[model samples]
Target: MARRVPRPAGAGAWGRSMGQGLLRKSKIGDNKSTQVDLWGGACMVRQVENVLLVLEYFAERRAPATVAEMTDHFGWPRSSAFNIVSTLAERGYLYEPRARGAYYPTPRWLTMAQAVSEADPVPAALTRVLDRLVDETGETAWIARASGLHVVMLDVRESPQMLRYVARPGMRLPIHVTGSGQALMARMATAEREALLKRIRYQAYNRNSPMEAETVRQQIADSEERGWFMSNSAFSSDLAGVALPIRIDGHAYAVTTAGPENRFVPRMPEIAAAIRGAVAAECGAGALDMTPLRAEA
Candidate 1:
């Protein structure tokens, strides 16, 4: 821990590379890492890891935890657990609602988390686009951004239809097969996209799913030509999706409308048009791009 120092104002790729490495070396692989804590146990910084795990425990247990409970939960010595919990209590992150009672996290934790998330919250215009897609197409709509080889749904608007693709924020979808994933990849530089494509583990989510990088590359290529993306690809075998890539401050994100194939497939062209119109109307013409997203090397 003493060996590394903080990155300065102009940190280079080493900083970016370190962050990417943490995401890439997930014990659960590229897909599940973000779905869990942003980088939790995967972070080599041990002290921080313990704190996140403690918070997650409180979250899961949904009950105030005594020091003894913490001890038993983490298998730490009573003194070690007491010290950790005590430190958090002193810092106002944890407290006993009743004296001599179990310790519970304070609102400070939630407020601070909210502050951080809101600092770079999803664009408001994108929210409008998602709502528009739901209104126009009457299907589940989600906005996702590429996270490693998966696209993490940042927000979701469920369809009113009885048989729709029920999705939620924080759902992770395979990068190679999802329409949101394909649109996101299409916005990346060719070399970067190729590198990610090569690393993809193309599972046969369905008999028609692409099984190779070339196939996916061609999909992106076709998407670049079509100006939007659509797929029968699914997290559930019977679902289908349409996605359009948009860039916000140079970051790639996709807004998608998805549902059961029986209903969604027949309306693919209409849905894609709706998505494109919504993006153009709510996000402005500049928000959509066909030029590759290139980060400074």
Candidate 2:
């Protein structure tokens, strides 16, 4: 049996549940654990999370991993762990630098990641707009697009301040409470917006965050008239944000500026204008493309 992580409590844990205890054990899953079958899918696929966890192991260990070591760490059968590691080596993602040595990842994965980032849907025009926001507001600036019920940060330029918001690319924020999420959700067609809203697993980290759909609806309605939205300590006690949606290359996305509440709220007017002005200046009538930045499962 593979070792299991103790899942964190509450709504956030949904982001990490990848393989739900593969088929029950092969000498390789004990044939059930390494590859999991979807609830009704006709074809079963190898658990992608295995590959990710393997990579994470390498990253944290900073050392090559042998098949025996992999099996012991994950509680997998030796053969299964061997197969998984060998498959990665066969794919050019991993290599045995030393003959008869343990395997380590090659640069292929990094090269592929660079290629994908270059091909991102966010165009140079929008990135320039994000850059301008970061410069003008001295707060972290980012571009976000909706993925199902969450907003994903596609590109970000962090603030230079000593206590600025640190934004990670590909981070997901819930739709109902984040300014970026709200901006993107509000721009969706009414039916689509309402449907997505109904699916929200709402929670509040602080008093300022709206904990119900109706509250968010009212917030969106009010922001619709103003053309921008704000989240005051919504995701966490200190994080605050402001955003305005824009269309670039025929797709919709939001440009957001965020920072610690103490410093960020006072600069909201300045940050908001920077975002709006940059979009107007760089894009003119162009729209933001919002195709998923990740492969949909």
Measured by lDDT, the strongest candidate is 1
* lDDT agreement with native, every candidate: 0.72, 0.69
Model 2 C-alpha lDDT per residue in residues 1-297, reported as the tens digit of each score: 223331211111112111111111113112122332112122324467677767756754577777877787677788888888888888899998777668899999899988988786678888898888877888778999888867888988877775666555666676788898888877777777878778776654457878888999999888777667899877656677899887764577889988778877888877777787888889873443333222212
Question: For residue 11, what is the lDDT in candidate 1?
Answer: 13
lDDT of 2 at 30: 24
lDDT per residue, candidate 1, 147-182, as tens digits?
A: 888888898787776555655566566777878889
- Could you tally the backbone clashes for each prediction? 0, 15
Judge candidate 2 at residue 78 and give its lDDT.
Answer: 83
Residue 227, candidate 2: Cα error in Å is 2.9
TM-score of each: 0.67, 0.71
Model 2 reaches what TM-score against the true structure?
0.71
